[model samples]
Target: MQKISPCLWFRNEAEEAVDFYVSIFPNAKKGEVLRSGESGPGPAGSVVLVNFELFGQSFQALNGNSDETFNNSVSLSVDCKDQAEVDHYWEKLIDGRGKGLACSWLKDRYGVAWQIVPELLPRLLIDPDKAKAARVMAAMMKMVKIDVATIEEAARG
Candidate 1:
């Protein structure tokens, strides 16, 4: 039992969202699901809450109203080991109705924000050469999805 878990609120789409998320992550799966009862606010037998895990991180999905929606204020960051890994996630996430944003940020079909970043990003940003680091930053700012090779080239300049 994790001490704290992020709860995602969906407009009666918790089940679908959980399934989508589990399918994307290798180590993820659905756990328990609680359905609303006849006297509950939602339709009887409809999904009320779902427990799941993504990359070993526990999370709960709630089938609530659309009064609240996902925003960029909070986002999940995926640290990829290489450009291939970064591209894989970036492509997979934006395959359906997702949109790509600048600086490796993207919003999934469910409006969930994700940052697909390469592990080399931190190393490049903290490089001893300030000019190289600035170049990397400038290059990253111009990209919707991060290209590790491009960043490396920028750092080398």
Candidate 2:
């Protein structure tokens, strides 16, 4: 049991977002779904909250029923083990439903931002060799999705 989990806020799109997320992650499982009561916050029987697990991490989403939106300030970061892993997640997350941006950043259909980063990225960036680290950073900055080979090549220079 994790001490704390992320609570996502959405405006009447909690279920849809959860569904989309579950579809993308192979290690995902759908959990309990709670609906609004007759007392009427939303229409009775409408989904108010949903619980699920993604890659063994628990998440809860609420139908906030507000105009508020998700911004880049908070984004889920996936540390991919390799280029293939990075590519897999980047394409899967986008897949015409999302838009990829600079430096492995992307926004899914629900406007939730994600970072499909290679695990090697941070390691290379923090290397004792400042010149190689700077090269890796330069290469990564111009990339839409993180490329492990490019990062490795930069680190070698």
Off by over 4 Å in 1: none
**TM-score against native, each model:** 0.95, 0.96
Candidate 2 Cα errors over 4 Å, as ranges: none
lDDT value, residue 112 of candidate 1: 89
lDDT of 2 by residue, 1-157 (tens): 7989999999999998999899988889889999989996789999999999999999999999999999999999998888888888888888797898789899988889999988889998999999999999999999998878888999999
Give a tens-digit lDDT track for model 1, residues 89-131.
Answer: 8888887699998898999998889999999998999999999
lDDT of 2: 0.91
Model 1 error, position 121 (Å): 0.7
